[model samples]
Target: MQLLTTYMVRSQQKFATIFLISRGFTFQTMDFQGKYHIHCLMQLDLKFSLSFNSFTGNVPADLGSLRNLTKVTFSYNQLQTRPDGLSFVTDLTNCTKLQLLDFGHNKFKGEIPASIANFTNTLHILLLGSNQITGNIPPEIENLNGLQLLTIYNNSISGEIPYGIGKLRNLMDLSLWGNRISGPIPSSLGNATQLLKVQLQENHLEGNIPLSLGQCRQLLLLALSDNNLNDTIPKEVIGLSSLCIIFDVARNFLTGPLPLEVGNMSKIVDVDLSNNRLTGEIPTTLSQCLMLQYLDMAGNLFEGGIPPSLRTLNGLQYLNLSRNRLSGQIPIYFKNFTMLEMLDLSFNSLEGEVPQEGIFIDTKRISIIGNKELCGGIKELGLPACKVHNTKKRRKLPKLKVSITVTVLFFIMLTCLIVVVYWRRKSATRPSTALPTEERFLKVSYAELRQATDEFSPSNLIGQGSHSSVYRGILDGNQLVAVKVLNLRQKGALKSFLAECEALRNIRHRNLVNIITVCSSIDFTGAEFKALIYDLMQNGSLEQWLHSSENQSDMPKLTLIQRLDIAIDVAFALEYLHHHCQTSIIHGDLKPSNVLLDHDMVAHVCDFGLARFLCGSTNLDASQCQASSSGLKGTIGYIAPEYGLGSTSSLLGDMYSFGILLLETFTGITPTDVMFKDKWTLHQFVKAALLEGTKILDPSLLSSEHLAGINGGQSGDVDKVRLEEGVAAVLRIGVLCSEELPVERMDMVNALSELCAVREKFLRHGM
Candidate 1:
């Protein structure tokens, strides 16, 4: 290591790139005595990135002498300096070509140097987050007119945000959250029309939100929550159509009614205005936010009835209106809110009967703890049964008896007609068959299904399962479909059929197979017949594409990008079912065969027969989900190890399965492959291979044709590095997801984020 350092110091001109990422080596503390030779390298124009390393001691002060330096990232290191000093920052002013500078997640203390204004106007990004930087942002920062992103989060910086920041027309992202900043937001921020994301949450900012902020027509995310802001939300700000990700102003002192134009954010996914002083009714206009998935207005002063139009939010999953002044009955139409998962209406003045349908069936999911007038929910809610208040009307019942006698005489004649019809049905001996109470499927007859499948011929058969056979067919003479016919001869066939109908009818997603129709009626043999029809997947199941006979010659191999896309699609599907659905659905059997791909290779999760809904969305504290299922809920190779220990099912279990699927996709090896024997499981196999580089990756992804010239040129090696990095990221995520302990596995959301980051890096690195 000492020799390498000496060589780097001597060959300064040739040292163009300095990368020591993830080497896990620690450096000794050294002050450099202000004589570091790196100052000589400044003339050569270098690009240095030492992220994810264990570098200690103060950063080299001479680094600022590199005028030709373009980028410097030193995040996630152990670097530190004197508590009240940032001398190196002042030195960096000489680097006229510097466009990116990041020093986040380190112990950089003291006030940010005023010399920050000396940075070149070409600088586009600056990240100083997760540090001990103090004092207010220097007004002189406005000098960097070309700045695009500025993040200084998790700092002790104080004072009002400078209005001069608005002068930077090129600014697009500005985040200063988790700071001690105070005072009202500057109205001049509206001048920065290119701003797309603004986060000022967790600050001491006070007063009303600036109305001029509405002029940022391109803003996508606005988070100003956890502040001292007061007054009503601006109507124009609420009406910004470009705000799509989230608009959070919760935990503030804001008052007055929400603007009626709140419905204008059609593309927004989350709206949080909770823990505020806001009053008046929830705007019925909120129903117009068709894409809303989360809405929280709890701990407010909102009054009047819960808007009935809220039932129209078909995509809403989380709704919190608790601890408010809301009165009147809970909207009866709330029973139609099929997508609602967590509904908190507790601590309110709401009166009358609570609807006993939809999410209301789960006591843990729907809270009404403080609403004394609420009654008639499930017995578990401990509310009294609803009763009539008008007892005086009982005395008038005697006068109606004479009229009731006449009505009885008329009913006797009707009974004679029913008896004649009943005798005819008894002679024919027709057995009454009960059908499952399906929710949202086209009700079809047995004859229609038979005709669609050509009388259930073997030629139409596409796939066969334990208790059902799927056949490809055409419905209504044009709609291509896949009909799953159940065989009652199996012991649990009928139960599986009902379970699938109940599961699929209650949930829907683009990644989930669409149930086109269902047929439950008597067949030609006078016996019960049941089947479920789905939109046909032209490309068939992923299982066929992975392991089918290669001799067919027409089958297309899945490239690395395609596999990554499929992994993302499956992860999203599981995220929706496990976290975003009205109730968590445990996909007991997640396997390659259960994953269908359309003509575009977009994956759709299928076969909910083994699926079951968990009572609570995230109440996996004790495995209540697993206890709800009669037996284990997944296939052999992908099943979580916890399931074998008699533990209950949980979202973590599904994550385990997804992890196995990702590993299998990248390695082209299944858990049940013949080579996996004894203690050499797929997880251990892949984990070991990751230690050996890309030896376990699919050959088709890293063919010699693409890798041969990779050793010839600098750009070739860069592409090769990116490819390896992408593969390493995938393998790392897979190993983490398939950990032995369920709690050790990565959450689906975090996994998705890492996958996205890796993809972005691959694109940016030109791979």
Candidate 2:
């Protein structure tokens, strides 16, 4: 150790300039006076970038003696104290030539000392974000006249922004969001005309926007939302022609007519003025902003019809004028706005038929509700007709008696032709004997299905399950379909196959996979069976994406919110089956493998081979009695425990399966994996984790702590925060649906209400 120390000192003295170490090093307290008389040897260097590599002990203040040093970087390191604890780089002021400095992403704490002003002459970029720095921005910061970028976000800073901040004439980017800064925005900030991006949201600032901000002509993004700014939007803001992006003034107390001059910002792309008190008719001039793509004026007092001029905005993709007092007929010209993807005009007084052409034809993407007088072409809206009635007209008719003679002759010829045509078709296409509808499946010829599937080729197969295989096919001039062929003998096992067919034929739901038709036939070799056809799900089954190792690279990982969405969709399907069907249908098998996804990743339940329909007072014991089934009937891990005890399939079984699926979604782990066995089912795993605060689940699936910070809350306190009130409601439904006892669980209606509550919350929160 002594030899190494001697070598380091001898090297430091010879270099007298910058030095860098290629490997890790450690250090302890050193006596500056005894260290090679270091004060006079002004240029000292380190062998490695400073980091948390076991460098302990206090930062030596005597190191300031290196007056010739120009750069110092000590990020991610554990220095005991800032070299000058209560001051900012004061000891290094003697190093007048200092130009670059980086001390970020570390454990620096306490207020940034006002002495930071001493670097005013040379510092160009200052990044103190992502640290433990606290306290108010010192008024002395106005002295950093040469500073170009200042980012102090993600800290515990407090107090008002200094009014003299306007003095930073060279400042181009400033971000002080995600802090506790309070007080009115200083109008003097308008003096920083060179600023290109200004983010001051999520603060406690209150007051009207200063009119002088119009002077920031170069500003491209200005976010001041979620504050207490009041009064009308200053008209002077219209002068900022360089603003080409977001112009959000949501959630404020701003009132009065939206400025017509807003249309003059032709380059603007998005404008949000939601949750304000703005009144008056939407200005037609807004259509003049050709580049505008998103317009949200919801939760306001805007009135009158949607301006006809808006139809000219072919680039508009999202438009929301909901929760307003707007009145008048929907303009017929809306057909011209073909690019519109989302249109919400709910809770308005707008009247007239919703256009059936163009974007409105896609009813799923539009919401036009709460307008009592409004009528529409949408089938689900149940809107009344608006055609005017006229009841005073008369017409004369000519009598015809001779036509009967010609009609009688024509009927005789038609009857003979029908007889001959029917006989020929019956001989060529019909079967010798027709089975009763209740006992028969649609008779599609084996040859036709074989052609549709291109000779049952492996390349045409879309999916496969334990008891069946699914193939994609094009039948009858290009009608795409998925054919699920059950692996069962056709002639001898008619009863069992028919029962499965009857169960699926009777059920219907948007989220339950739709069966288009069925094929039953015998082939030339005397083999026969039944196959059900359904709409092809473009994305295939969820199980393949979630569990197949070979397909892992192709499958997209679902984010937390997407997983929550899929869970809700599956719950709705189960709820519908449990309550809305004429005779309750129990999808005896509910698992990710049975749930398919469409192009949008919307889940659809498929494969109803084990499904059973329950009639009133039916003997469930006999009805649910099955032939010897292998494995677990359903997927191994998702099968309800009661099913193993010979319990009749019930809604509770589906709930148990759904609970397992939910846990799988949250943990990104399959319930049947070996790692989750022996009292380690997903249900037990999640329950244990939440109960004991253990790290049993993958951390990547958890939302980051900083996400709460974006909404003006503490990162560490997020778990303590209640699930969003509406999400809490849905969660209650999930809890009720997954109750251990069958009788305690909620019926489909109640469960659906809970799920709808989540959608309501999203609508209310403008998500």
Q: Estimate TM-scores for all models.
A: 0.50, 0.43
What is candidate 1's lDDT per residue for 16-39, written digit by digit as tens?
Answer: 226322223344332233222243
Cα lDDT for residue 284, model 2? 54
Worst 10 residues of 2 by lDDT: 1-10
- lDDT of each prediction vs. the true structure? 0.80, 0.68
lDDT of 2: 0.68
Query: How well does candidate 1 match the true structure, expressed as C-alpha RMSD?
Result: 19.9
What is the lDDT for 341 in model 2?
Answer: 88
- Tens-digit per-residue lDDT, 459-497, candidate 2: 467677556778776565235568877777432235445
